[model samples]
Target: MFGELEMVKALLDERKRVVVLTGAGVSAESGVPTFRGQDGLWKSFHTQDLARPDAFESRPELVWEFYNWRRQLVAECEPNPAHHALVELERQIPNFLLITQNVDGLHAKAGSKKLMEMHGSLWQVRCTKCTHAREAREPLPDMPECPVCGHLLRPGVVWFGEPLVAGVLKVAIDQIGRSDVFISIGTSNQVQPAASFYQLAKDHGAVTVEINLEPTPNTGLMDFAVHGKAGEILPELTTGLRESLS
Candidate 1:
């Protein structure tokens, strides 16, 4: 890990465009649930059963109940060291972008200005009838409604069957294509589009790195694979980059 850290730091020393893609494992360090496997079951319902548009359509109340629970749970968790390290990376890199799959809003809380929440955020709500959306951190009602319209509101996250916002996806791909260094952090590397981003970066000649608790399916593709808790690895990696830059 130390040797790989030095290599990643050397890559960053080039001062080229850097892009980072993070996932649930990053937030899990802060005690946020990944909403997968056994622990994710709520009221005997799986996350996939409730996080789809059809599920929300059939039982908006039930859906809101789930989301509200998630909101409350995520609200209690704060940004960990990994999140702060990414913020530092953003500050040090002249051309940097952080694309995150986790919607917990930890990166934003950690003061990441150059960020794209590809999966949307738990802190936002959008109108079901209109395009209006806004941040709402408060405990919403049993059924949240849009202030702009009288219709019901839904969690602003991209659901299981929903496509990512086209413009945001476009920008993320463009950044990955242009990146000199691309890092995949704490993701399972199984989710689509994002799952393939490392390949896109590599195809475009970017130095790819993976930081995860364990090797992912895409681990073999990375120029460097550093395994450990992101909260520990990221701060050390970013600190090394800072020292190398100095």
Candidate 2:
């Protein structure tokens, strides 16, 4: 770990464009469930069946029930050390971007500024009829309605079979292309496009690192891998970075 910290420090000292990608593990540290791995159940229906456009179109109330439940669950948790450490890192590095696959909004709560939510957020609502979307922290009704269109409001997250928001994906790709350092934390490395980002960064000459509880399929490709809880590891790494870059 000491040796890897040295390498992480070296990467930080360069102070070039740095991108950090996070997944469910980070949010799990804050007590958010990896909902996909759960029983996938929702009132006798599979969650996977409900997390698609077709489900929302067919049974909007059921979809809203699931997302609203998720929203409350996520809202109960607080940002952990890793989230705060990343906020400090963002402050330290001018060209830093934090990309997260989780929809919990813990990063935003941690004060991350140069951040992009790859999976949208549970705290936001969008109208099905109009293009209205806004952040809402309170618990949503079973069938939230848009202020503008009065249409049913839906969770802002990316559902199954849905493509990522194009504009967001473009920015994420641009950041990965420009980054000189890419850090992957708490990800399974199975989700497409995002799972491929570290490699994309490496291909573009970035030093890629993976920090996870255990190795995944792409762990072998990482220039460095740190196996540990992100909350414990990130703060220590960020402290070293502050010293190295001070």
Candidate 3:
């Protein structure tokens, strides 16, 4: 972990632009269960059934129940070391972007700037009928209605069948396709859009680095793959980079 981190740090020091694409692995450090993991509350319900737009239409109360539960869980968790490291990394690097797949607001909580939430955010709400969305101040108790259309509102997160927001996706692709360096943290590379960002980065001649607790399918494709808990590894790597940049 130490040796590879220094090597990656050397790349970071030299790179003009560094873009990061992070997955649920980054937020898991903060005690948030991933959407697909057995520990996740979604175990009882299939993600496709609960998260889709059709599901919300058919069962408004169920959709609210699921999101409300997730909100409660997120409310309990705080940003962990991995989240803090990214914020610190952003502060040090002059050209930087952080793209996160996890809907949890841990990145913002850790003070990360230049962020793109590709999968949407759990702290937000969007009207099922209308396209309006907002950062919610209070958690949903009963099935809430859209203020504009008086239709049911659901979590703003990207569900199974829904497309990623085009504007946000376009921006993420633009950065990933042009950065001099790209780092992937804690994602398994099983999901699309976010997984494809790595290849896009590599396609554009970016130095690629992966930091995770264990290697995944895409491990072999990365320039460097460091296997360790991201919270522990990222802080160490970025801490050195911070001092060096200073």
Residue 175 displacement (Å), model 1:
0.6
Global local distance difference test of model 3: 0.86
Candidate rank order under TM-score: 1, 2, 3
Give candidate 1's TM-score.
0.98
Local distance difference test, each candidate: 0.93, 0.89, 0.86
Q: List, residue by residue over 1-246, the lDDT tens digit for candidate 3.
A: 678889998998898899988988888888888766566447478755787878877887887888888789898899998898888888888899999888888899889978988888988988867788999958675888888999877788888888988788888888888899999999999888777778899999998999998998989999999999988888898888878877
How many clashes in each candidate?
A: 0, 1, 0
Model 2 earns a TM-score of 0.95
Off by over 4 Å in 2: 39-44
Give the winner by TM-score: 1 or 2.
1
lDDT of 2 by residue, 4-120 (tens): 867887788875789999998898899988756554566787777888999999989888888888877777899999999999989888899999999999999999988899989
Candidate 2: count of backbone clashes, pairs at least 3 residues apart or interchain: 1
Which stretches in model 3 have alpha-carbon errors above 4 Å? 40-43
Q: All candidates' TM-scores?
A: 0.98, 0.95, 0.95
- Model 3 pairs in collision: none
Residue 68 in model 3: lDDT:
87
Top-scoring candidate (lDDT): 1
Positional deviation of residue 88's Cα in model 1 after best superposition, in angstroms: 0.7
